[model samples]
Target: MNEERAASEQEAVENDVVARVLASFENTPDARLRLVMTSLVRHLHAFLREVRLTETEWESAIAFLTAAGHITDDRRQEFILLSDVLGASMQTVAINNPVSGGATQATVFGPFFVDDAPHVERGGDIALGAVGEPAWVEGVVTDLRGDPVPGARIEVWEADEDGRYDVQYADARVGGRGYLYSGIDGRYAFWGLTPTPYPIPFDGPVGDLLTATARSPYRAPHLHFMVSAPGLRTLITHIFVRGGEYLDSDSVFGVKESLITDFVVQDAGTPTPDGRELGGRTWSRARFDIVLADSE
Candidate 1:
């Protein structure tokens, strides 16, 4: 709430309304939760006053949120989708992950992440029959100073050439996503579908909101990565295809210059890092060495 202006009696009543709501949280058990609630109330009330929100509009907002809740299930999360499109997800990530010692910058963690992704061995294929050209993804996990941080768990996922994640389908098949650990040398590798530009799931309330506001639902072509190791900040980020479409207008606004990287094309039968042949089929490869900051 703005603390100072020409105070009026009606405005005093309004300010008192805010004060009373804030006072309600005085007995909250958790200090952090109390502070967060207090801040939220202040902002929310300020918005209501600034916009002079109507009762009908408030009811509409409630209906929208109720629809979001109804659409959210074990495999789909409409609220995270809402947060992504609103830039809330990225804002939270930025606040928690400042530029520290040149560590890889964080970005939005999309709604599609799963708790127990299948494991992939070093240089093993994670595509699991998803459609797209084969690509080799290799990276090293390290500290800000570049020392190897072995045993870092690297979780990865992406959509297929047709721009659909596995979970978007009826079967919820686990393709195009998996996890692997860094080696003693801090190196990890896996095979995945080369990413393509794709839309966020657009059949829910988020989609209706975007349509009503003239927004595009497409995200830039990218592969998701979440790397974690003891004593280092866990990083949720994506490596976008350097020249992929929709880079400038990603629906979720997750593109970062430092995270855009090359997906170098390879000739059929090109010798892979592990010396595997592609049976005369062309492939692509990318290298993304990651750096982690010390945990806060």
Candidate 2:
């Protein structure tokens, strides 16, 4: 009888703590804020209760997050990396962008995007200094009704064959990223490095967490794109290499079947789209037509 009474008392204390914390947000002026806070508190407390988290474990979590913050800067985003590995980024994307009307599916936006990326003309080259097989990427930007969406801005970036983004270089070189606009015919094309599979940075807290959990940090080979046009929902997505390894287990959960595409290989003497000589080096080509959805 005494043991049962003690257990009941513990349960009462836990419930009371959650209730008090939630009640404190009852007077919040913003209804959205109040709702968010209430849900957060309830879920957080429930997780703690379910896990029976100890003081030491909580301290460890705090320290881990602190380390992640310390290492973040203009070139690196440890928090987003953490979110990607935990599947939170993908979950948020799914909630915000649902599949409908044949529009392209949205995916996790990795942490490597930078503002003010160098601008390239249509059919221009984005592989300024990166080393890899030359890639010819061409596509059209259109709406659901199959009409051209002229002047859509397209931002593209990808890793080099070395599995490193341009920002990861110590010399601060810029390559493998540029922005272009669709022509009047909705067609856009560019020369870039062929997409390559690469591991996420594995030298920091996020990497440590992945190591601790026995998880892989390698993302599938893919080319990233962010397309925006007037009166359309901006799309952030990727074209994953078809039949590539790691597609089923991409570190960021960014792959969709619709995005998988063939990277067709061409011989050294093949005629290039822009007639640029490859000097006996083989290259690849991929076609990815985009469809934009109306913004609600």
Candidate 3:
């Protein structure tokens, strides 16, 4: 066929695909869902058109997606990792979470948060048997105006000094089930060895995709959180360690300037109820206030 004819045929195919997709959403009960799906299909097709994507490349992408799903299990979430690396997770947060003046910014929750983490008291150690620089994290959950949000619930999780989460280990008792929940007055504190920056899981298909794209896999050292209250929108965010090597180059593209905190090194001379003395030891401290939006 002539070049013009081939181009016309391609346009027809694209139009037909768009029509079918849009038609299927015509009766959608949810207005927001219909609008989002319609826009997604439009942009997706436009992207393919602009890139002049090949059949081989498209098939490869399909296979990659299939492999990502196949690798998911109760403990592993490949799709979230895929979204994170591709910046979709960040985009979703941006679109859904608009900052209200002084409200704390929202961020990606990451794929590692497990449900029902073991609850521990304030100042309890989440790093059970891990050896590294001790760190103290304390903060209050409040509104943009700095008013304390009493009874707010904040859940926390993070990797150990080795840059590994608890669920990643076969030995569940080791650093697994990290601390969760907040105390009275929306105050929460925990003790853990400082975590090191590490790469996301790279032994799987997601890794292969990143390798193919020449993208780095290192995420900045940070703690994960899910903060919520009775009358506010829940927040899923990370508190990045200041001065961490990967701060400016998070592999998952999840880091934000507002999220970075100075993990100050404290002397070991400080006394603790656990009988652990803060003598000449170094520790990191990050204090971030969570501001929740009033629920409608």
Candidate 4:
């Protein structure tokens, strides 16, 4: 009788799971969402059945998730990293962006973005207050047809030479705290030190997972960009530095072919805009245009 009762309870739990999963779609207003949810539920259940996942494994996953949550703070976004490494973030972007022929390819936004960075004028130096090799990044926002989209806003951010974002360190002694707004012609330029490849924080559970998987925690050198304007879809992407190690193996799997750009080193003898002799050191320059999709 006890064995029979156990079987009945297990069956009841399974049925409840199915019912609840199906019921979630009843109030979904969007037909697409309803369909997606239904399919997701079916596949999820199928996966469980296929795996025959043990309760111990489920408990371990829950514990890992709990640790991931516990490691998150204002500046550290382990959950975002978790989503990134899992490819869920990129998958969502791909689904939403849906290659429209000429639209810019969307990628992960990463976890280090900070709102309301101190804005600077066009061609201004974002790394002025910091230290590193000087670099000038200039670009225009255009449609796929190469027509400039004037007044498009290009929000940019990057890590310092030390591979740490401004918010990552509380000392304020590290660099990387600059923001630049593009001009009316969709032209934007800013000066900063070249960003270097760095390892993601490995003190958390996600890091532990990566370590267990024998994956390196280093990201390729890249600059983050978010371009948007009225009547255009926003683009969240990165311009990876060409020839940088880790391009083929980004820790978070955020690299894309179209986004890889060469960082040209200009001769130090070049004339400066202010008539000052250009510093006698090689500097990197990357220029890429962003194409935005038309908002339907």
Candidate 5:
């Protein structure tokens, strides 16, 4: 009887602690902020109680987060990597951006997106120094109803076959990133290096966490695209290689079935999509159509 009474008292104390913490948000002017804080407090306290988290474990977690912060810089983002590996980013995207009709599925924005990527002409080459087989990517932008969305700005970026983006290099002059606008037919095309599977920045705390959890760090080969039209919601997505490695085990959990595309290999001497002949080097081609949802 005495033990039961003590347990009841402990439960009451835990519940009171959560309540007091939630009450501290009462004066927050923003309703959304207050609600978010309250929910966070509730969940955090519940998790602590459920796991019986120890002070030492809490300190270790804090140290891990501190390490993540320390390793972040202009070239690398450990926090975003952390969020990606934990599947939080994908979950947040799914919660806020449910697809309507045949709109392309959304994926991670990744940590390497550059603002104001240089615009390129249709069929232009973006793989200036990328040392891989040339990949010709062509696409059309359309509304969910299949109407062409001419003049849509299509921003595209991808890592080389070596799995490195331009920003990863010290010179920052590496290629494989560019943008183009769809023509009257809603068509856009550019040349990029075929993407190859690469590990997320695996020299940091997130990598350490993944190793500790026995998780692979490889992400599937893919090309990132952010397409926007005047009356449509901007679409952030990736077109993954159909047979790419790590599709089933993407380190970031960013793959979608709808985004997998076949990268067809064209032998040497074959004519390109724009009618240029590939003399001695093999090339690849992929066609990915993007459909955007109507803006609210």
Candidate 6:
């Protein structure tokens, strides 16, 4: 009887801590903020109770998070990478951007995305100095109804054959990234290096976490795109290599079946869609049409 009473008292003490923390949010003016904070506190406390987490474990977690913040910089975003690997980034994208009406599905806006990518002429090359298997990418931008959306801006960025973005380089001269506007027929095309599977930046605390958890840090090869036109919903997505390694096990959990695309291999002599030859070198061709939702 005495032991049972002690157990009940302990349970009441834990509940009191949770209740007091939740009560602190009562005066928050923002409805959303209050709700979020209360829910976060409840869930976090529940998790701690369930795990019977010790002080050492909590301190270690704080240290790990501090290390993640310390390592983040312009070229590297450790928090975003942490969220990506935890599936939080993709979950937020899915919750906020539902793919109704055949609109393109959204994925993680990876850390490598840069604002103001240089504009390129239709069918121009984006792989300025990068070395990789040449690839010709052609696509059209249209509404869900298949009507052409002329003058839509298409921004594209990808890692090189070595699985590294241009920003990773010291000079970062806009290689493997560019933009183009769709023609009246909604057609746009460009040349770029075929994206190869690459590991996420695994040199810091996040890397240590992944290693400790025995998780791979590799992401599937893919071409990132942000297609936008006036009065239409902007699309942020990626066309992944159909047979690329890591598609089944993307560390960021960003792959969707619809995004997988065939990259047809061709001999160097094969004429490009625009009837251009590439100095007698072999290349691949891929096409990805985007369907945008109405912003309203």
Best by TM-score: 2
Runs in model 6 lying further than 4 Å from the true structure: none
CA RMSD of all predictions: 3.3, 0.9, 2.5, 3.6, 1.3, 1.4
Better of 5 and 6 by lDDT: 6
Against the reference, the lDDT scores of all candidates come to 0.93, 0.94, 0.80, 0.81, 0.89, 0.91
168-191 in candidate 5: lDDT tens per residue?
Answer: 888867588888899999998888
Per-model TM values vs. the true structure: 0.94, 0.98, 0.89, 0.86, 0.97, 0.96
Per-residue lDDT over 1-296 for candidate 2, one digit per residue giving the tens place of the 0 to 100 score: 69999999999999999999999999999999999999999999999999999999999999999999999999999999999999999999999888879999888899999887899999999999799999999989999999999999999999999999999999989999999999999999999988989999989999999899999999999999999999999999999999888999998888999999999999889999998998989999999999999998
> Which ranges of candidate 5 are over 4 A from the true structure?
277-279
Alpha-carbon deviation at 232 in model 1, angstroms? 1.3
Error of 6 at 280 (Å): 2.2
Best by lDDT: 2
Per-residue lDDT over 147-249 for candidate 3, one digit per residue giving the tens place of the 0 to 100 score: 7777666677777777788778886655633654565577777887666798899889999988989988899988787888887888888888888888878
Give the local distance difference test score of model 1. Answer: 0.93
Residue ranges of candidate 3 with Cα displaced over 4 Å: 1-6, 174-184, 268-275, 278-281
In terms of lDDT, model 2 sits at 0.94
Candidate 5 backbone clash number: 0
The lDDT-based order of candidates, best leading, equals 2, 1, 6, 5, 4, 3
Lowest summed lDDT across 10 adjacent residues in model 2 is found at 92-101
Clashing pairs in 5: none
TM-score of 4: 0.86
